[model samples]
Target: MSNSPTPSLVKNGKEDFHHVEGLTSPNSHINVGDDYANNVNAKIRNPLLGISKPDLLAQVTAFCKEHDLEDKTSVFRKGSLLAQHPESFEDIEELDEEDKITIREEKTHKWRLPWALYYTVAICSLGSAIQGWDNTGANGANLSFPKEFGIENNTWLVGFVNAAPGISGLMSTWVADPMNNWVGRRGVIFITGLFVIFPVLGQAFTHNWWSLLICRLLMGFGMGIKTTTIPIMTSEIVPAAIRGGLVMSFQLFVAFGILVGFCSNLVFYRIGPLAWRFQLAAAFAPAVPIVILIWFCPESPRWLLKKHRYKDSFRSFCRLRNSEVIAARDLYYAHCQFVEEEEAFKGTTLAQRAKEIFTIPRIRRANLGGAIVMVAQQFSGINIMSFYSSTIFKEAGSNTLETLLASFGFGLVNFIFAFPAIWTIDTFGRRNLLLFTFPNMAWCLVAAGCCFLIPAENSARLPLIAFFVYLFTALYSPGIGPVPNVYASECFPLSHREIGVAFSIFINNTLSSILGLTFPSILSGMGPTGAFGFYAGLNMVAFVIIFFFLPETKQRTLEELDYIFGVPTRRHAAYQTRTWLPWFIKRYILFQSNARLEPLYHLEGLSGGTTVEVMAIH
Candidate 1:
């Protein structure tokens, strides 16, 4: 008579019933005082008394189907599911290829790369392009801007112009976490767009050196915010299967922006007095679209869940995933992850959460890892070439035209090589890519330095130096270029990710400032050979540090990293880095074959303790 569905009555004591969570109707059986005693006497002592396990499971399965509760792992933890349904495994093993395919199709959703996702990701990644443009665009302007500003000979003035935005970026980066917390990721980006636009416009019009410097500093404020938030937002929005590539796509756009800026410089170069101003203003092109596109996309679903806006989170998740079932499943796990994180930081305030970054060993390690990648990215000398390619080329005995052409070549090579990274990052993986490319970067830098050591008049001198520079971009773009952003974003907990990334950016810009501000002086003093040799040593050092410390993060969920880093369980120093590549490749193949490769950790029976049994779906 009650609204809830009642368990079917046994026919001749053969049919069975199970007390399955979310399946059993609460109103089916209830009593008060003497009524309870009467009901207990009327029925068997155990609620499941006389019920067989197999029949009970059958009833529960029917109930699950009726209720649309498709998540089998929720009803039965993965280990328990397999253990209780032993016949299922036997059936699985005995199935023909066609039947196996049918079963796989029934169990897993087919993954299609959605257009909306790519559009959204590409739109968000424009921030990186803007970064590339703003940073390297100045390199072309530097040749002429110094003359217009009447600060051509002042090394300090040159350094200040180059470093001004970074200095502002470093100072403003501390606010990134707090602002991101206050405003959503989308809001922060929109704000960043404003900062990016107006200052760049100001740089285009400003006559006085002081006004240009002010514009550069203001631009940093926006850069700090954009650099920290975009990668985190990108990671959170996309599924783990393509997270590496999508996030790296942000870096890819950075390469595109660099190339675009280089082209812009060439077009504006012959235009005389206004060439430098137009170059400074060219940064506005990327920012305008970012501001427009962000409004059309959804805010981060994870951030929505954190804010307890479940309805909004679900809506956002649905838009991103383009599936109600997948969105619901993702939301369910996100809820669990959020609850766990909340309990961990239950009594702590924001300040306390900030302090725990250092106090907590796992978080501290994550922060350290993030720091290493950010610092290594800067020290690898990518930016030295990016921010001061003109200076380097000029020092290599190139005339003005040759120097401009060389800068354009550097940007083009950087842009072209970034495409390979999109595939290799998800396929070959983050740590392995770093290992493969950084040594090559070092070698190229060494070779570049050797070319500079040749006589200034030799025809081989500039060409060989340019070749090595191009080679460095080729090696660096596919490996180190994108890995740092992907690696740093992966290293922190969702709660800490904003601050973690902000801290990493702060360190990154600080180093950028120091290097960009000081590189000319370094080139002047050490000459091109010595300057590049110094970079070569640093790249080699980066290789060794990454080899020892960075772990393989391919194919794992953002939440899985918490455990991956916690106990040194699977992806630790104990396992050789080389072994991970083969293991990941095999897993990837199984995934593509629709094998439904669940993580063994999801089977709690293996460990026999309370653990986060997150099933990593392909």
Candidate 2:
């Protein structure tokens, strides 16, 4: 075959219309059908292509004919057109439509985030704060409530009381995806606020441990839904450039809630026997505004797009974005993404969907990564230390007053360190931060555990334990604290995002429940060293899993990740461990001088649609 092949002769001894030979185009025009062609026409234009559609199509035909890929042209999917004939279009342009839009949008968009976007996300994210407050508030309350309710020495009652929210969170997490799918993300979040408010109020007035447990359980149910939806909702609203930082604001507020809960406990501790009641009730304050403010915010544009409400999605996108161009560009790509998803899952039923989630190699890998992230976050022992910080301090030889102050310090460290993630999540990339921090956390846990083995009579005992505990929070807050929430939310394809996130949350809650329920028993049986040692071991295991499994999700749009993880083809389950990614890591991430770096990540040949975009993050 020549470098540029000629069209084949027809049955009538005349030339065909210059298409690839094997393709059977019955008419002069290609009948790509309504869904595929319409989406490509409206949503797939890119100045970066530097060629007209007719020219590009002709070139693709020639390239296919030369390469004997003529049969591939008859099957048109969203990205398959480009993926099938990449060598033909290599010199056209470096960027895709999404990158061009990002470049054009750089100056056109606002310097400050739009107030509408800010307030909406800020208010919705308060649910995480409510989660933070509800989960951590119990810790302070448990210190005194156990004694007041005559369960201070009863380890089982204490564990049950502490674990209530997690148990309920697990149940609610199971229902969250279907609920969000049914009522929408906003509706689930709205309903969650009610759960947070009333349940916390119930705890405030409860007279017995069982009653308090009931209140905590209800609060957990609310948090379960809220936590699952917040990241999804936030990510859908923001532009890809800042989505990481903004979604991370959800965890930042969570840290703030932890701080508030601890401070509330500290102030209330000075009040006498009824102090714990005030601490539990204080969580209700943040919940009230979240309920009202969410009413003002539009439903997620992605969710609207998923429902095929195109006009509504466009309007919602306009509201979420800083400019008309950004909104328009993002909306088109979102539509293209949705259309591809629809085609991919066309005839599949619910049973098939579930089966595919487990059986499809890429989806399985993505879910496995998601589950690992959530489980790592839980088993890293952040909550173990968080829920029992006061107890841990007491075990380290602090008096009651010192323990309370030390616990407050833990919350402060958590709150303070979380601020840096807003920058690091986007700048350092997701996988790098996790790789760097998980080992630090493991070291801290191990070191802190060793502090407990020191004789109580030693002068350095209390300070060393305090230093390691505080360092643990400092290390954890920046990486494991926020990344898992954003990472899990971004890892799955749009079709499975809600259920994927919810499933991860379910894993989170299940692990959290086990950890929360077992802490008191673990403390009783293993002492502080054995408990911390166990967690340290888990963190090390998590580090290995993340290093080998989780791919970097920074800077890529949710749609772009589908190609990177091989969602459309299911070919590359071990994406991060593969060739291209390691080359990327060594050259770009490690800044290795000898490493070869590609200027653009040419995704044209990877996806199943011509509408797919190339991502150049550097």
Highest TM-score model number: 2
TM-scores across all candidates? 0.78, 0.80
lDDT of 1: 0.71
What local distance difference test score does each model get? 0.71, 0.71
Positional deviation of 212 in candidate 2, in angstroms?
1.8
lDDT top scorer: 1
Tell me the tens digit of each residue's lDDT in model 1 across 27-106: 32322111111121111111222233444445445434543454542332222223223225334332345433433442
| Predicted candidate 2 versus true structure: per-residue lDDT over 338-431, tens digit per residue | 6546655555554455555565444565678788889889878989767888888888898878988888889999999999988888878777
Pairs that collide, model 2: 78-609, 78-610, 79-608, 79-609, 79-610, 80-608, 80-609
Clashes of each: 0, 7
